[model samples]
Target: MITLTLVGIGSGNPEHLTLQAVRALNDADLILIPEKGKAKDELAQVRREICANVLTSDVHIQGFDLPIRNEAITDYDARVNDWHDRIAVIWKQQIDAHLPDGGKVAFLVWGDPSLYDSTLRIADRIQANMPLDVKVIPGITSIQTLTAAHAIPVNTINGPFVVTTGRRLRDEGLPAGIENVIVMLDGECSFTGLNPDGLHIYWTAYAGMEGEINLSGPLSEITDEIIATRKAAREDRGWVMDIYMLVRSTP
Candidate 1:
């Protein structure tokens, strides 16, 4: 049986590793790291650094090229499904090659797997083809890190909140009967399309990591500032991981 462990490493900081995650890293037979590209080399490096910083036992660590999603696929779900299939195949290939006898392999996931991450879903594809035992070690999510960085409670007392993606935020305005909403995967800064009145936004780039940027205030007052800051950071680093929380300022 192949033991697959998905360990959440938290936002880009090496210090984000929990004791459980450290133990899982040191216990793995093989650790797979995704090599996105030259532009996101640091993401892979951060994974390596986590191992370097916390791993005590010698573990086989390998870097694999991540399959880039085909934008030409047109259908969003289809494109994502195809991309995941490719990744699962790559993972299976790596496991077969390295662990002919069936041993434990681990992946370092950013934030908790239960959140917007697709790691768990991709792992299901591998399970379809093999006898697999999966274990998930939860770590701090970007949402938690974002709120912690801002030193604000995630929701008002006795109130409910919703978490969504930028696409939904743009397509469907804010959810009804909710005062707080979180957009986790927003490359487009969907808030720009919304009416800023009575909306307060707390946005941060690279939360819990170096070069962190925080911008918060009346959405109307700092919408342009957040956009410019996001653009500048992306240009400087070739990539940016960000999240923002929008609260209805009035009622």
Candidate 2:
């Protein structure tokens, strides 16, 4: 049986890597890094830097091109499922070619795999084709980094918060009774559509990295600033990952 370990490398900072993540890196027989092309090459580069810093054992490292999801398909679920299927095939081919007899293989995942990441789903697809044992190592999430960078609590005292994606936030708007909403995977600034009177936003892009940017204020006052800053950051870096928390005051 092949031991498939998914190690969460945390956000962009190498210091964000936990002791367990470092140990996992040293123990892997082979580590697979996904290349997301030139546009996002820094992401893959960060993983390499982490390995270089922590890896003492001589382990084989391989880089594979991450398959791009088809945007032509109108059905979101169908598009994602098809993309995951293709990724699984590529993963299997790499494993077979490198370790024909089966051994411990690991993949470095950004943030925790359980949160908004499809690595677990894609791994399930791989299990259907081969004997596999999956293990997950959790790391600091973007929400954690965002909150820490902004020096604010995620939820108010004796209150709750909802974590959701950009698409859901846009389609559903802010949930009716919830005071705190953490939005991720939001390429579009969905907060602009909400009634910004009583809402405060804490936004961060590239949290924990050297070039991290943060902005927080009443949503009404900074919505345009956030949009312009986000656009400029994306243009300068070739890609951008951001998360924001919205807190609406209780009447």
Candidate 3:
């Protein structure tokens, strides 16, 4: 049986590894790392760093090129489904080449797998063809890291909150009947499209890493500053991973 472990490594920080994640790392027969081209080499580097720091026992580290999704396809769900199929093929090919006998293979997922991550979906695709046993190791999420960086609670006392993707927030606007929203998977700063009136925004890029950037306050007041800083950081590093929380300021 193929033992597939989807381990959450947290927000690209070596220190974010929990004791359980460390143990999972040590027990893996092979670890898969995705290389996102030259533009996002840091992602693969971070995965390697996590293995270097956490794995004392010798474990096979396998790096594979990540399949880039075609955003040109207008149908969002269709595009994602096609992408997942491609990724699963790559996963199976890598595992088969490295572990022809189907031993334990692990993937380091950013944040928790239960969140807005496609790793689980991709794994499921592979399992349809191969006999597989899957396990998820939870880790601190980007939402938690963003809130902690701002030193603010994710929601008001007894207030409702929602977690969503950047595309939804931009397309749907602030969701109905929710005071707090945590936005992720946003390549562009979608907040620029919203009406900033009475809105409080807390933004963090590289949420839990050494070079984290944070900006908060009335959206109108700090929007420009956050955008400028985010641009600079992304240019400096060749890529950036960011998340933000917004709340309609209340009396």
Give the winner by lDDT: 1
Candidate 2: which pairs clash? none
Task: Show where candidate 1 strays beyond 4 Å.
Answer: none
Tens digits of per-residue lDDT for model 3, 65-111: 98899899889899989899999999999988998987899999988
| lDDT-better candidate, 1 vs 3 | 1
Higher-scoring candidate on lDDT, 1 or 2? 1
Better of 1 and 3 by TM-score: 1
Regions of model 2 farther than 4 Å from truth: none
Count steric clashes of candidate 2: 0
Per TM-score, what order, best first?
1, 2, 3
| Model 2 global lDDT (CA atoms, 0 to 1) | 0.91
Each candidate structure's TM-score, on Cα atoms with residue i matched to residue i, is 0.97, 0.97, 0.96
Runs off by more than 4 Å, candidate 3 = none
Clashing pairs in 1: none
Candidate 1, residue 246: Cα displacement in angstroms equals 0.3
lDDT of each: 0.92, 0.91, 0.90
